[model samples]
Target: MTRHLIPLLVFVVIVGFLWAGLSLNPREVPSPLIGKPAPEFALPQLRDGGNIVRAADLRGQVWLLNVFASWCTPCLEEHPYLVDLTRRNLVPVYGLNYKDQRSAALEWLGRHGDPYAGIVVDAEGRTGIEYGVYGVPETFVIDKLGVIRFKHIGPLTPHILNEEILPLVRKLQT
Candidate 1:
């Protein structure tokens, strides 16, 4: 009887684990880099390959680093919202063009709208990996001192921008 109960106990434990996982939100996956300094990088600018944008250069400002790709469908969905956010000028938004061609990135930005104050090309995706990017359309909120405060996975929606991102930006700016 004890031996038979072992299998039933194992099944119960598995179910408990699954239930815990299901209760958690996928978009809110906690990033280890939160409260830590953002990864340092120096990548070529999308508009001018001759110019490089360094992570260190952006100190003393609260900003958003949006990771996007031309081929990512969610990125297209997120673009207009980012454009509108830039119009507000609450915080500077920078783009990391992850693992995409320069020509395609430029064309996509042209077709939609250029929202970024500056865009850096991460054609090899090395910088994205450094930032712990699971996929395209991830965004990071960095404080004035260069510490990462928040990380949002997936596309930005009006609700997320209004309820979460904007509030954090406002607090960080002050």
Candidate 2:
């Protein structure tokens, strides 16, 4: 009877852990980079590989660094909001073209609409590794002094843009 009871208790504990994990949202996973200086990189521009976009060039302003790939479906979902934000000109949205062929990324943006102030080609994914990118469609909000204020993993929804990203940008701008 005692041996049977020990196994039952172990099973119950495992079930409890599973239940707790299921209750948590993946999107809310905390980023360690927040409030820290953004990792710097100098990469070729997507449109003209000869031209470079360095992280240092954007130091004195609030900007959005969107990490996206042409193959990502969620990137397409979040694109319209990015376009809208660009039109509003609230902040300069910079694109990090991660792990994609240059021509494919160019075609995707041209077809969707080119919404970035400038696009950086992360073709080798070295920049993505520096930023600790687990997947495509991650975004970072960087303040005037080059500190990463927030990171949004996955795609940005209208609710997330309005409620979190924009509000944080506004606060940082002033």
For residue 94, what is the lDDT in candidate 2? 96
Off by over 4 Å in 2: 1-20, 26-28
In Å, residue 59's CA in model 2 sits off its true spot by 0.7
Model 1 misplacement above 4 A? 1-21, 26-28
Count: clashes, candidate 1: 0
Candidate 1 per-residue lDDT, tens place, 1-80, comes to 98999999999999999999999987666889999999999999999999999999999999999999999999988889
Point to the candidate with the largest lDDT. 1
lDDT of model number 1: 0.94
| Model 2 agreement with the true structure over 1-174: per-residue lDDT tens digits | 999999999999999999999999975778889999999898999888899878999999999999998999999999999999999999999999999998898889989998899999998899998888986899999999999999999999999999999999999999
